[model samples]
Target: MKARTRTNLWFQLALVLTLGTLMAWGPAVPVQAQDVVVKVGNIIPLSGPSASVGLQGKQAREMAVEEINAAGGIQSLGGAKLVMLYADSESKPEKGVAEAERLINTEKVHVLTGCWNSAVTYPVTAVAERYGIPFIVPVSVADKITEQGFKNVFRIAAKDSWWTRDQFAFLKDLQEEFGTKVSKLAFVYENGDWGKGFAEQWKKLAAEQGYEVVLDEPYPSTATDLSPVVQKIRRARPDVLMLVSNAADAILLTNTLAEYKVNLKAVITSGGGHADPSFLKAAGENARYLFDIVEWETDINKPGAQEANAKYKAKYGQNLTGEAVDAYLAMYVLADALERAGSLDPAKIREALAATNYRSGPGMIVGYDAVEFDETGQNEHASLVMVQINDLGQGLERITVWPKGARRAGYTPVFPMPAR
Candidate 1:
């Protein structure tokens, strides 16, 4: 009887102490709201020859993510916050595939984006498909990337083929308005999938436009010495030069062109090195008056684009490039999908993406007429504008000169590049 009483007394004392502690603590504080985090993974060449393109894209998306979070995140999922994950592929296709796999399997990101350059995006997007992750392409424009008919892969920029027809129009305008007499046209590009498309399209267009193909050249992307190629260009004496190159090759060839003083009636380029800020900076005064077809230009006078330019300049201390503008829009596309999905299910996100008609929202910042994806997962209404670098010193400022509807006042395309 005495042992039982001692155990009962200890229990009574424990209960009394618990009550006293509760009384001292007062009313309980309500549970703090938990943040629902959505993870997005991106793989790009951050340290290779194309690193500038990747880094520029990275900064643009970071700016968008910050804006999204500041605006209270995704309201559909109780203020779900987005987290960004990035991996560098060093501009290698195999490395891009490996990094994309890591992002999907290890990091378990809900959506995947990036893998610039068509060479890298092809394999990396294939991985995203096998894992059933939604992938939005911001840079790579290889037609085959979307032609594979993968539902999970969607592209927000104009395809390579889509821009070719516009090029014909641009050329016509050049001849009629700028008095550039076109007879012989030389086509040159790096030997890769993207360059192949550029070359093929230029060949077809030149034939249709009644211009002789004087010189067609395909050089290695890693060709550091382009003096021989420049010599060939000098010998060909084409009336026009159509160069489709990435940034590094563009710099190399530009140097060669300057060295040999290879002058043509006009020079036109499709993206890559010719349309990039790094190329302009490296080429310096030589980059002036070159016609470059671009996805987006800082000087495009549009509602959302003008506003974005101001904000982008304030944030990055520089104007937004085509790659950066596309990337900025890409993040918004993912966020819009997440908000509409209302759940982390990849299938639902894909469905949301298919049904997307983000015309009036953040998707408009890139001035894409429509954000809706077609059956082939390509944006049906991606905006395209051409710009010419006007300033030739340390910094390059490319002003929109083509697509008269998008050009700003006081911006004129300098045609028939002045002889060096």
Candidate 2:
């Protein structure tokens, strides 16, 4: 053989050996690549009146997805990664319905969450139930949403009556501790389902607790002027003001109260406007001493609650809403179900979720001892906390006050709120 022919033979032998080695070792594929994708959809007010609450929820859900994906995705289902989708409900019931249908039909999401406002939640939930999609509500407090007996719908937050029950206990404790009895209450709530649902229960509960309902005023959720209603409350001379309005109305009512220099023993603001960041900003100094019953709080002593909040604030430039915290927890709840399911089938995931007993890891981050769904698809173990806005050294902090489980409460409740 000539030298060129010998060289060609050597090159061909090297190529053969390299091919054999490549075949034996396999291709250079990543060791951690996910084999499947679990798609979930979130429907909240990304725009319009209630966007403040919705925006926080949106960030929280996104953060949860990011955290879950970072933790090597789901262990079962061949390391399937979670994919998030969003639909803006615009804070309207009809819009919520439209967006939910779009997400289900177009986006092909496996499970759904949100539609924050109770008015929106009611209609949106109906749509999800109609389509056989599992819908987990993180924020809406309307009891009838779950009372309608839909298995596909689930709620992680306390029901409307739960807040009222907690309120009664708080009042009882306040009277015992401070001798400032709230015998008379003036109700000012919007006309929506949340406002109406809470007010209806509040009226019955307040009366049974010996609280005289002085003036039950129902205003439009979009009402910009609450002066007339404040005038009614002031004249009624109620010991406590019961507020069940949205963020905009909450801001308006608080500002109007301050402007009129109305004084009361205390003000009980249901979560809507009372806990909203916009209510804090818009109500200004008037927000101080305003007692709010909330589902979640940053000051909770849960292991990772504050750290999770810090990460949230770093990105969002504000504190997270109680609803937002719940939304974050919702993702983990779904992820837990997906992991146990070990399959992408919606029915299997629903079954796994129904059997969820998530007490650790990302699922219990909301401070609930255990997250187990009841027959009605509501988290029976879910509860709420009471937070009061106080002038802390840093600024206005909504410190948890009523619930003894709260990690930090600055002082005894401030009885007979000072005049503006």
Positional deviation of residue 155's Cα in model 1 after best superposition, in angstroms:
1.4
How many times do residue backbones clash in model 2? 0
* Candidate 1 displacement at residue 263 in angstroms: 10
- Per lDDT, the best of the predicted structures is 1
Cα lDDT tens digits for candidate 1, 1-420? 999999999999999999899876743433223546889998888998999999888998898999898898887878888899999989999999998889999998988899778899999878989999999898787789999878899899887787777777787887898776888988888999888877898888888889899899999989878898889999999988888888888988887798889988778888777866578778877777778887877768666787888888898788887789889888888888888888777889999998777776664666345688998888887857877777745466777877776776776777777777
lDDT (Cα, tens digit) per residue for candidate 2, span 1-420: 699999999999999999999876753433344556887888899999998899899899989989998897888866778888888888888888998999999988889899889999998878888888889898787788988888789888777778888877777787887876677888888999888877898888877777788888889977767788888888998888888887777888888898888989888887867767677877888888988887777787666778888999999898776778888889888889888987666778889989989887754656457788999988887777777788878888877775665536346667778766
Residue 405 shift from truth in candidate 2, angstroms: 2.0
Clashing pairs in 2: none
